[model samples]
Target: MTAFRLEQALGHTFRDRDLLQLALTHRSFTSPHNERLEFLGDAILNAVIAHCLFERFPRLPEGDLSRLRANLVRQDSLHQLALALSLGDFLRLGEGEQKSGGQQRPSILADALEALFGALWLDAGFDVAGRVIVRVYAGVLDRLTSGQGIKDAKTRLQEYLQGARLALPQYSLAGTEGEAHAQQFRVACVIESLHLRTEGRGGSRRAAEQMAAERALESLESAHDFSRQPRS
Candidate 1:
């Protein structure tokens, strides 16, 4: 099943089979897993996505383009790409990682997808890699046009508060969940004047804060009154 999916995703069969094998290897499984490949692929992926956004949105400034690229290339986005390729099923995981569910981990899956791109680049060169990237990234790139605004969480939250003349929003960690390595953070966004509190959870502190801000935004937007409603 994985073999077929890989063939379809890559759109090329490897003459040097070890390259394909290396791409699928996880660090938890092998000493020389795909980290190096992931590093190289990360650079290429950034460049490719940057180029795409630049060409597609000529009027969009650098900051906006950067934001779009960030949204597109973030961990969640890459994990979705891995899912599309059925990449998790093909991962060569160590016994411990396998038992602990490495396949479903966002970082592992995202990194593995980048490593696979790096592997494709090595096996077939730039042209092949370009095709693979464009193919896999087309949908995500399309979504960027209709995706959330270019504003970051902090900026958006600030704008919402300033506009309403409400006290500024402050963020604090409510708590942490999961283990040290895979910790999940819960963040609280507080409006001091209104005593409004909104919480969000994510894999990291910043992400948790952003989620909280987004929730606050949604809640505020849904209600007509900015003070009584959720902060947008």
Candidate 2:
């Protein structure tokens, strides 16, 4: 989408367009990147979440509120939001970064989401950006309140093993298939010193690992007779 369209979607036109430009500029593209903006955005996001949580869950204690905020502002959550906005296409990256798929990197996308909010705050004000954040985070808020955003499958498995004093789960690629450009990876998850194992497939090693871990978690949960926890 065009910058104009993005601005329109954001419901604010930047008087200093450079702020918006800087928000789109990755570290690969410039000496002084959007790191500062990301920092500011982080604080702003926390404050906004805190305020919302305070009002939404007046009876909720500090710890629960903190957990809910953590769930709402996680890297994966921000990356999903960035994808919804198609923010990846607007990122200004160096040639190498562009070619190396920086646009699809969760870390990059998550930081960019924060930077965009920072830019909006700078261009308009906290009120404007806070509104945007609230709108974007509505689903997260709902999930948190309903206890559906706590302890995702991955975390549940980790905790289950940790409580048993077992070693952390290990992942290995079992095989690959298809053409060079269209390759798919098969990954296995194994618990040390046990025959328990499971495998899964995906388009990339990381994706394969995730799928494998998920499968492992499901298998363990079923074997251990543990109730499925909410995903965060």
Candidate 3:
């Protein structure tokens, strides 16, 4: 798709044409790449999504809201949005990236989508970019609300890490407390790449693991940068 058509699809015309081009240009393409834009957009996207979830689901607790936001903003979700925009066709890639099919790569496409959001915010403001994000995610949000119960935290965490091609988190039995038959368990969830460790206490081993996973997921969503790939 041409840049003009992309603008039409995105529902925002850029005042700065160069910003739009920068957003679409991958690092491998040249200097002054989209990584910084991606970082800014990542923050804006998280804040916008958090606000949306908070307002849309008033009765939902913090953990559930975090889970929903994580699902919506994950690389796979952004990749789908990119594909819907026919975004790959418009990407400016280096020869190596182009030959390696970088346009279709989930990481690049997702980062580009975020960079586009960054561009939109710069061209206009949060109001415009937030609306476009909500619209782009409308179908996904609908499906999530249509009696799709919250996914298991452990499963959700695994999917999140896997989506970014990060190393799987390790869950270990830390210890136990209380007497026999009434003991509370402590589980530690560690993701080495992010240098993250979270602990959860529960009445059973599975419960403890799930709690740990939930905390870990929340930390990953709110604190860590999922855009970074682990070293080979």
TM-score of each: 0.64, 0.65, 0.63
lDDT of 3 by residue, 1-232 (tens): 5698898888888899999999999999899999999999999999998997888888888877887888788876686578668798999999877765566666788999999999889989999999998888775565466224445668778878787788899999999876564566789999999899999765567767876887786687577653242333
| lDDT tens digits, residue span 1-232, model 2 | 4688777656677898889888888998996788889998998998998899889888888888888878778886686567556778889998877766666666788998899889889988999999988887764465465333454545656776777777888888899876565566788889874567888655577756765666676676677654544333
Q: Top lDDT: which candidate number?
A: 3
The runs of at least 3 residues in candidate 1 whose Cα sits more than 4 Å from the true structure, single-residue gaps closed, are 146-232
Task: Choose 1 or 3, whichever is better by TM-score.
Answer: 1
In model 1, residue pairs whose N, Cα or C atoms come closer than 3 Å (at least 3 residues apart or on different chains), thus clashing, are 216-231, 217-232, 220-230
TM-score of 3: 0.63
- Give me the candidate number with maximum TM-score: 2
Q: Please report, in order, the local distance difference test score of every candidate based on alpha carbons.
A: 0.76, 0.76, 0.81
Kindly state the number of residue pairs that clash in model 3: 0
lDDT of 1 by residue, 28-69 (tens): 887778899899899888888888888888888887888888
Rank the models by TM-score, top first.
2, 1, 3
